[model samples]
Target: MEKFKTLGGSEGSTFFFSVERQKKWERLDGPIGAFVRVMPWRHFGRKNLGYLFAILHGADFFFDFDDDNYIKVDESTGKPVEILPSTTVLDNVMVAMSGPTAFNHHPMMKPSIPAPSWARGFPWEYIKDEATEGEPAFSQSIPFVSKLNSIGVIHEGATNVLVPKHAYSPYNAQASIHTQPALWATLLPTTVPGRVSDIWRSYFAQCIFADSNLRLVFSPPKIEQIRNDHDILADFAAENDLYTKSGKLIDFLSSWDSEHLHFPQRVEQLWIDLYERSYIELDDVVALQKWLEALITMGYKFPELKPRFRNVALMGQFNFADFPNSMTQIMMWSQKMRERFQTTIAAAPLNKTQLAYLETHRIDAIPARDLKLRKRDHLGFYNPLSNLMRTLLRFENSSTIEAVLYAHDDALLNLTELSEGKYPFPTDKIANRIKGELSNAAFVDLRTMPDRAKARTLSHRVFPNGTISDIDKTIFVNTSSELKKQIPSLHAKYKQWGHYYCAPGQQQMAMDPEFAMYLDPDGSAWFPFHTQSDFLIVPTKYAKPFTEAATMHLKHFIWIECAFGKIVDILQQQLQAPTRLVKLCTGFGDRRGRWDVINNHDCQSESVAVFHPFKIRGRFDEFWAHADEINFPAYSSRGKN
Candidate 1:
C-alpha cells in the first residue's frame, strides 16, 4: 500500500477559508469524462486507519481517492477488474479525508497497476455512471463548515482563532450566593410588603441613594439644625476603613429628599463626588438636563421608563445616592453590562458576516411588548423599564440563545424587589432558537471535568461524555417564576463578591463586587477573543458592536479607543509600575454618571490619564486611603427610611 502525509497543516487546524469545493463541483452534469472514486477502510478490524491517494479519471480533473496499494482495472474502458468490497473501500477512503478541500482542489484521476494485499478484500467494485441531475454523493466529505462538538475540538485548517480551553490560564471563582437565587433561595424574604404610594418616586429615590429612599428628604428644620450641629463631616473624617465610612455616608446621603430642604448643589455634590467618584453634577437644573439629554442624544435611551414632563423634571434632578458605594455600585454596573452584552451577542447574526464569531449561537432580535407605545406623543408617559424588561426577557428566552456564549460581568443595577417570583418560559419567536439548541441531543457540559480522571460512567451527570455539542445542554439556570425573582436573593448574598487582584499597596484588587455567573460545577461557557484596548477587554459582544458602530460614530470610536488606552493605564496604576498594564472594560456607566472618558467629547485627550485611578498598595488599602472617613464627610441621620 502507498503511504503519504495528507496535504495540510496539523490535524484539525482550520486556516484560511475559500469556496474551493463549490468551484470544483461545477464538473457535475456538464459532460461524461473520466470518473473519480473515493473509499474508506477499517484497520485493526474496528480500529480506524487509512492512507490518502489521488488518481486521474476525467482529463485534468482528479477523482479523490487514497490507499497504499494500486488496484488494477481495464484502462481502455475504465472498468474495474478485481478489488475490495465497496463498503470497506468507502470506509477506508472516508477515514483518510482531512477536510473538504482535500478532494475538492485536487485534479481528478484514475488508479493504475496491480492491486496490493491490503487493498484485497471481499466484494465487487465498480465506479457507477455519473448522476444526470445534480452533484455526486462524494461531496459530503468536505469539512470545516459545521459547528464544533467539544472543548478541544477545532475545524481543520483554520488558524488565528483562539482556543480558550487550551490557551488561557484558569482562574475560577464560585458563583456568589449573593448574586444567584439558585444558590441563595433560602435567604430571600418570603414576601415583599405593601407598595410605596409613589413607586416611581420610590424607584427613582432608590436609584439616587441606596440605603433607603426617604432619608434624602428631611422636612423638619430642627433635623436640619441637628445635621449642622453634629460633627458629621468630622465623624466621617475620623473613620479608618473607607468602605465602612462610605457605607455610613451612603446611608446618610441616600435618606435625604432635597425637595423639602432645598440644599445647595455644593452640599449634594460633595456626597455625589465621594460615592460616584465624579464631580459632574452642578447645581443648575439646565446643566443636569443637558447631561441627561446628552446621554439620550448619544443613543443611551432611558429604555422603558419614559418620563412625563414632571417625571423628566424629577429624573433630571435625581442622583444615585450612597447606595452606589463601591460594593453596591459595581454590582449594578455589571448587571447593565450583562444585559447589553447578552443582547448584542443575541442580535449579532443580523449583520450577516461570513466569518462572524457568533455563527454557532445566532439569536433573534428583541420583541417589543408595547409595539403600540412608540415615543408617547401626549403630555403623560409611562415607565419604560417594565416594557424594556419584558423585551429583554423575551429575547433572553429565545430559542437562538446560544449556550456557548455567556456574560462574564455581574449585574450593575440589580433590583431584587423587582425580580420576585417564577418567570414562565417566554413564548416568542426568539424562544425558538434558544429552545432548539437546548433540545439538541448532542450538547455536552464541560463543567465537571475531573482532576482525578475517572471513567465517564460514574462522573457527574451534568453532561454526558462523548457528547459533541452544547445545543442540548441545561442552559437555563433561573428556575424561579420570574427573572426578577432571581435578583434580590443574588444581591443580598453576593453583593460584595468579585474577582480579586493583587497589586502595589493593595494586596488584592476587586474586579467585580457581585456573584459572577459560571457553569455550575466550574467552567466558562464563553471565550475571550480579543481586547478592546491595552486595559479594556472586549469579548465577542462588545467587540462586534464597537467595531460596527465605530465605523459610523466618532463618539463610540473615541470612547472605545480611549477605553483601550485606559486599560493599560489602570493596569499600570494597579501595579504602581510603568511596566505593568491595566485591563479596562465597560459596564455602561458609573454611579456618579461618569462614562468612559473617551466618550466625553468635552474632555481633552489628556483626561484619560486623570480619570484612570492610580494603583496604590492593595485593593483595601488603596480603597481605604482614597475613601475612608477622612475623605468622605458625613451627616447625622435622625432615622431610617
Candidate 2:
C-alpha cells in the first residue's frame, strides 16, 4: 500500500522513537511503541573507554550478536555475550542509525479502507523496486512530512543505552528501518499488473486515512460465480499477512454476496464466507443493524424473502415479531395484561368473581334478585388465580423472560382479577380456614406474602408452629432436622395430609391451585378447655370431609438429612432395599412424600422400620450421640431440606 498521510502530522508520526548513547559505547537503534528490551549491565564497563566512546558517537541501529562479535570478558571487565552473524542481526533490526541522528525506519502497518479521507484523491504512493540492499531500495514519490522528531537515540553518558518509547527492538531496528523505501516502491504501480496492485494499494490508503470510528464496506461476489477481478490483490494481501491493521479492510469488502443466485443456501454461504474472512467480530446489536442496513441497501424484494436473509445474518437477535408470528405476539400481549392487573389490583378493592367478570367482559357485572324471585348460584370451577400468580413469581425469578410476561398481559390481567377481591371465593375461605387452624401450633408463622403489608397478618395466622409452603422452598429452613427438632416425632411421622388442601402459610399452593400445607399445633384430640381454641379449630367447610381414617400407623421413624446432590443420589441408589413404601400426605395434596419402610410386621408389636423420624438441631455433632440408638443408618432432612 501507499504511504499516505492519515492525520495532519508526520507520516506514521503517531509511531516514532529515539535512542541515547550509554557508557559502554555499545549502542543499537531501539523500537518505537510499547516494547521491552533485555540487556546486560557489565557491557558498559568504565575502563574500556567504551563508555566514553558512546558519549561522542550515536549507536549503530543494528547491534545484534551477529554483527558486533562482542564476547564476555573475564579480566574483571564484562559479562558474556551470545555470538551471532551480521545477517541474523541485520534481519531483526527494524530502524537503524549510523552516526548523528540519521535513522532508518520501516513503513507503518496500515489498515485496508475503501475510501480514506486523508489525501484528496488516490492518495497512496508505491515503490518501484522490491529489493532491500544498497542505498534505500525505494521511496514514496509523495513527500510525507517536512520534519520528524528523533528522541533518545544518543545517550548522555549513562551506564546503559536507553531507546526512546515507540522505537523498534534494539536487535531488529536496522532491518526494519530500511524497508520503508521498498514498501513505497511497491505501492507506486508501473505496469498492467501494477495497476491491479494499485487497486489494493488505493484501498488500503483510504482505510488508513479515514477517522478512527469509521470502517469501510466492500461489495460481495455473486454466489453462483466468484469474480476474478482482483487476483493480484488477493496475492498481495495473502503474502503480507502480518499487517493486522490492514486486514480489517480486506475482510469487509469480501463478505458481500451478489444477487445472481436466488437460493437461500447460496445467500447464506456467501455471507458466512465473508464473516469468516473478516477479522472483526461485531456485537449482536451492531451486527443486526448492519444486516438490516445491507438488506435495505440491496433493495430486497418479497415480504417472505427479506426476513430470511436478516435472520441468517443476525445469528442471535432475530425477534419473532420480525417474522410475523401472530400466536407468539398474542401470548406476549396477554401476559402483559396479567402483570398490569396483578400490580394495580393490590391497591384495588375487588372480589375474584367481580374481577373475573370485568376482565372477561371488559366491564364488571353484578346480578340482582327481587324478594319474589329466587335463583340458584352459578356452579363453576374456581379460577386458580393466586396459585398461578405464585407459580408466575417462581417462574419469573427462575427462567421466565420479561418479554414473555409483557406479551401475556391480557391473560395475566384476567388471572390476577380472579385472585384479588372482597367477595369470599371458595379459595379465599379455604386459605383463611387453614391459617386459623395452624395458628394453634407453637410454630412461628412464616407466610409468603405478595407484599410486606401482609407479613405480620400472615405470621399471626400460622401461629404455634410455622406454616411452610412450597413457595418457601428456597427461604424456609424446613429441612427434616428442623422438622424433627421443632415438633414431636409422632406428628412429624404422620405429616398432616390435610395441610396441603389449603395454602401453607399465606403463599398460594402450586400443586393444585386450591391446596397448601398449613401445620396445626394443637392437633391432638385432647387439649385444654376454656382456652381460645374455638378460633384455632380446623375449618373444613371449604373442602370435602375425609370419611375414611388413615390406615397406615407410625410405629418407628427415621429421618435422613443431607446435601441436595449427594444424599439424593444415595437415596436413589438404595431404592431397591426390601421395604414397603409408605404414602405420605401433606395438608396440601402435593404427594411428594413417600417413606421407605425397611421392615414392618402386619400390625405386630416387634415390627420396626430401619428408618424413622429423628430430630436434628444445634450442630451436626448432636446427631452422633443418637447414632447407636438407631437400628440402621439414618440421614436427617433437618439440614438438607
Candidate 3:
C-alpha cells in the first residue's frame, strides 16, 4: 500500500501502474479510466497490481501488505515495534526451517492463546481436530496454519523468536515481503473469489518458495488491523474455494513429480492442472504468463528454472485379480507418480491380463519377477523380495531411475487422505526425499530413534527370558530346504540369534549388542537395521547391492522386514557413507500395527509421504470414504471410471 501511494509523480514508472490517489478505486471515471473496472470494483484481487507496482518502479524487493493491517504502535513508546530482526546471519544458535509446506506460525505469533482460526486458504481436510464447541476442524499437527484472526480482527500481543520446524505456513498480503525472485507468488487471480484471491496467490507463490529453497521467515505482528465494515457471512461465502480446494492444491504441489520442471514453470503447470480440474480459473494463469513475458521483454532475466527430472521404478506386486481394487489403486499411483517422475510400474508378469491393461493405459509396464514366498518362517519372505530387488537393480536404464518405492500392494499414497485425490499416495517429492537422504547403507526412521542406540522395542514391557536360544524355532521348522541350501550361513545366524527377531511388539533397535556380536563375530560396525518394512524405499544404485547382500552368509531374515534391514546392514560395510532414513508416514510399530491401519488412518493421514498396509482389497470403500470424504469408492474399478 505504501509502495503504491509513493508512486505519486513518478510518471516514468507510473505510466504502467497508477492506482487512484487517495480516491475511490470503484470509480470508473478515475485517473486510470474504465480500466479500473477491468479488474473488478472494490476487490482484494487488485492487490496483485501492487506487485506490478513494485516491479515497475525498479524495486528489487517490496513489501506486499494490506490497508486494513496497520503498523502496531507501542502505547508505552511512540515508535515502531521491532517484530523481527533486520539481519541474516547463521550460527549453531540460529534456528532453521527448511521447505515447510505451510508454516503455521500464528500459534507462535500468540503463544499463550490457542490460535484456532484457519489461515484464509488452509485446507479444511487437514483441520480435522475440531473443538467440540462448534469450532472449525483444525489440523492437529499443523495447528497454526489456520487461525481466523487474519480476518477483521484487532490483534494485540508479542511473539516469541521463531522456532524451526517444517509445516504449511501461508504468509498473506496482509504484511508479507515480495523480493525480486519471490515476485512470481504475488499474482492475485482475477477470477478468484474476492475472499480467497489473496490466499490463492499465497499458495501459488509459496509452492515456488517451498520447492526452490527460498527463504520465508515469520515474525511478531507488526500491524494491527482495524478492518472496514464487512458482512461476516459474505466473507465466509467467499471462502468456499479456500475450504474445498486448498488441500488438493497443496497435495498436488507436495507430490508434484513433473520430473522435469522448476520454479515458475512448475508454478504454471500447477495452475494449468488446477484449471483442468475446474478448481481455479485459467485467466489467472495467463495473467501470470504475461507478467513473466513482460519481465523477459524488458531484459530482466529470471533465475533459471532448474530441471528436476527424476525417473523412478515403482517395484511392487501390482495384482488386480486377487485384489480387484488393486486395479484402481495401481492406476491412481501411476498417474500420481507421472506428476513427479518418468515412472515405470515394474510389476511381476504373473497376471498377463493385468499387464495388458497396464500397457493399454500407457502405464509403462516393466517385467520384474514377483517370486512368491512359500514358507511362513523368519526367512520365508527373503527370496521373492530379493528376486524383485535383483530385477529392479538391473533396470535397462538403472542410472536413469533415481529410486525404487516399495510398498504393500494395497498402499495408497496421497495427501490429506481424502478421496477424489484429496489425498492419494505421495510420489515426486517423496522420491526426492528418498534419493537425497538415503546414502549407501539404507534409509531408516531416525526421528523416532533414541538419542543413543540400544536394543529396544515398541513397548519396553515385551522382553524375553534372560538367555533363550531357538526361541524362534520357526527359523528351522518353517525354513524351506531351498532357502537353507541358498543361504546356509544366513540360516545359521538366524537360528543362533532367532530369539532377538522382531515381532509386532518385540522390535529391537538392533537387537541386543551381544546378539549383534553373535551374528557377526568378525564384523565391525555391525549396525542392526530396523525391520519396519511394510513399505520402504531404496536408492536405485543400492537396490542390487542390497538384494545381493541380503543373505551375506550372515544376517538372514525373520520376515520381509528383516530382509530389508539385513540387506542394508550387510551392504553398509562396503559403502563410503553412512545411512540416513526418514519416516514418511504416520502409522508405525504399534500393537495391531500391521492389522489395523484404518483405525489409526484418521490421525496418520496427512503427515506421511507414503502410507502403508492400506489394504484396498477390503478397505476400498473405507479408504475412499476417508480420502474423498465420500460414501464409498465412487467407481468400482478404474475401468468403470
Candidate 4:
C-alpha cells in the first residue's frame, strides 16, 4: 500500500511494543474497527485485530511472529544481539531464486547440506517424489508486479518464503515481518483452522504480490524455532487442507482471469473460490470484506475492490452476499432481541404494555400458553424453555441450524479464552467445533461448570410410591388404574386416574415425572436421565425426537426439569448416537440460598465463565464489570493453530 500521510511523528529510538487482547473493546472507530466484534467469540480471525493495531499506531514496519520462536542469542555475549540490526541484507550481498518462487530456510542446516527436509506446508507433490525422498525440479513461475520495501530477506528465517509475483512457500505466524507495502496481507484468515490460518494468508498475499510492485527480501538468521510441545498428529490433522489443497490452490490462481479486478475483489474472489470448493467457510470471506473496509478507512489505498462481476453473473449466479453478514449487524440483532425479551416477558411477563413494546422490535415469540405452559406463574422447565424442544424441532424442519446452545439468559457465558482469571472459561473453540462434533453426537449437554454436581444429583429423580399426603406436598397425578376406579362415569377418553387419588397407608402415586412418564402408556417402569435445564446443545437430526419426548412429558404437566432432561434419556435408548454431558459453561442454577454472598460477589474471583442465573440485568452487569476486571493475556495466533 502507498503511504498517504504519517499519523504520528518519525520513528523513535525506543522500541515500543504492546500485546493486544483478542476481545471486543466496545466501540471501535478509526482504523482499528476490527472484526473482533463479528468474530465468533474467539475464532482465529480475532488475531487480525493486531494488524489494525499496528496501522492505527502508525507503525512503519511490523514484526509478526509466534511467541515460542524467540530471537537467537549470541553464544559469546550471551545476548540476543546487543544491538538490533537495521539491515537484513546478509554478507552485504543477495541472490534471488532463479528456479522456483519459494525458499525454505532451515537455519540449523546450510542450503547445500543434503539432509533435505520439507517445511510444514511444502507442497506434497514436490515432497513425494518417491524416487528422490525429498527433491523435485521446479520451473520458473509467472511474474507478479508488486513494490518491494526491501530489508533484503530474512535468511535462515526457518520459514518458507515466497518469491514476489511468482510462487509461494508457506510463511507462517511462526516468524515473519511486513513492511508497509506488504502490511495489507498481515490480516490472518478467520475461518480456516487456527493451525493453517497463516499458511492460508501466505499463499493469498503472495498471489497479490505477483501482481503488485511489492518485493520479498532476505536477511541473516535471527530467530530460532523453540517450538512448544505439540502433538504432531494433531498438527497434521489441522493442516489437512494445507497438505492436500496447496497445489490445487496454485492451479486455480494460475488460471484465475482476474487481472482487471481490484485488490479487494481479487482477495475476495480467491477466498470465494476456496469457499465454493469447500476449502474454507463463508465466514472468512465476510471477514475479509470488513478487513478491506477497515484498510480503506485508515487511508491506505490498494488496487481497489470494485469488480466487473458485481452486477454481471459469471456462473449463473453471484455467490457473495450483497449485504455482507457483518458482525455489527449480528450485534444489532442480538441487542434488539435482548431488549425485546426484557420487555416481552423475560424480566417479568406481567404487563401487556411491555409485551406491546416487545412486538415493536420484531422478536418472534409464541405465548407460553400456546405451548401448554401456565401463564399465571412460569415454573419447572428451564424457565420458559418448555418451548426449547419445539424450537429445536422447528430448526430441524428448516435444516438451517446445525447446533444449538440452549442457555438461560442468567447464566454467564465465558465462551472466549479470556473469561477473566476468576471465571473458569472454556479451553477450546465451541461453536464451529461443536457443530463438527455433532457428526458423532446426538447432542452435548453443555451445562455450566458449577452445575455438574447439580446435574449428577438430579440425573435420575425417584418416586418411591406415594400416599394421600403426597398429593398436596408434591406434584402427582392418579395412576390409570386408580382413575378408572375413581371416575368411571366420566368421558371415555378422559382419565386423571382419580385426581391424584391415593389409599390410606398404601403406596399409590408415582411422585416424580420420571415415574409418571413410565406409566403414560405401558405398565412397565422406565428410568430417565436428568440434568440442569439451564443449558444444552442439540443438533438438528435429533431435534424432533428430543422435542417429542419433552413435549410428551410436558403434556402430562410434568416439571420442566424432568421434561427437559428425560428427552435426552429417551434419545439415548431411541437412537444410536450418544448423548454427551459436557461442562461447557461457568454458572449453574441460581444460588438463592447464597444471596448474602452474591450481593458482594467478586466475579473476578470466579473462574472465567458464561454464568447463568443473572436473571436481573443490573446484577449481571455488576458481575460482568467485575468479570472484565481481570486482564486478558497477550494474543497468540500460532499456539492453537
lDDT of 2 at 254: 21
**Cα error of candidate 1 at position 179, Å:** 34
Clash number for each model: 115, 112, 37, 47
The candidate maximizing lDDT is: 3
The per-residue C-alpha lDDT of model 4 at residue 45 equals: 54
Better of 1 and 3 by lDDT: 3
Residue lDDT tens for model 2, 208-303: 212111111111111122333557657565434223333333334322333423333333343344345543222312332333333333233211
- For each candidate, C-alpha RMSD in Å? 38.1, 29.7, 17.7, 24.2
RMSD of 4: 24.2
Order of candidate numbers by lDDT, starting with the best: 3, 4, 2, 1
lDDT of 1 at 637: 15
**Candidate 1: tens digits of C-alpha lDDT, residues 1-641:** 11111221224433221234322322323111001011011211110011001111111111111222233455776775322212221121111111110011011112243232111110011111111001111211212221111111111111112111101110101100010101100111101111111111122222232211111110001100112243655544532233122233323432332221221232233334433532111222232232233223323312121110110000000011122232222222222122212222221001233113122212222222232322321111111222222333333333433211111111111111111111111111110001112122111121333422211211111111111112123323222122113233221222211111101101111111111221223321211111221111122212222232222212111222212222222322333323211112122334322233212342222211112222111132222222211111121110111
Candidate 2 regions with alpha-carbon error over 4 angstroms: 1-641
Q: What is the Cα-based lDDT of residue 472 in candidate 3?
A: 20
- Best TM-score among the predictions, by candidate number: 3
Give the deviation of candidate 2 from the true structure as CA RMSD: 29.7
Which portions of model 3 show Cα errors greater than 4 Å? 1-8, 11-41, 74-77, 81-84, 88-103, 108-117, 128-167, 259-262, 299-641
Prediction 4 TM-score vs. true? 0.39
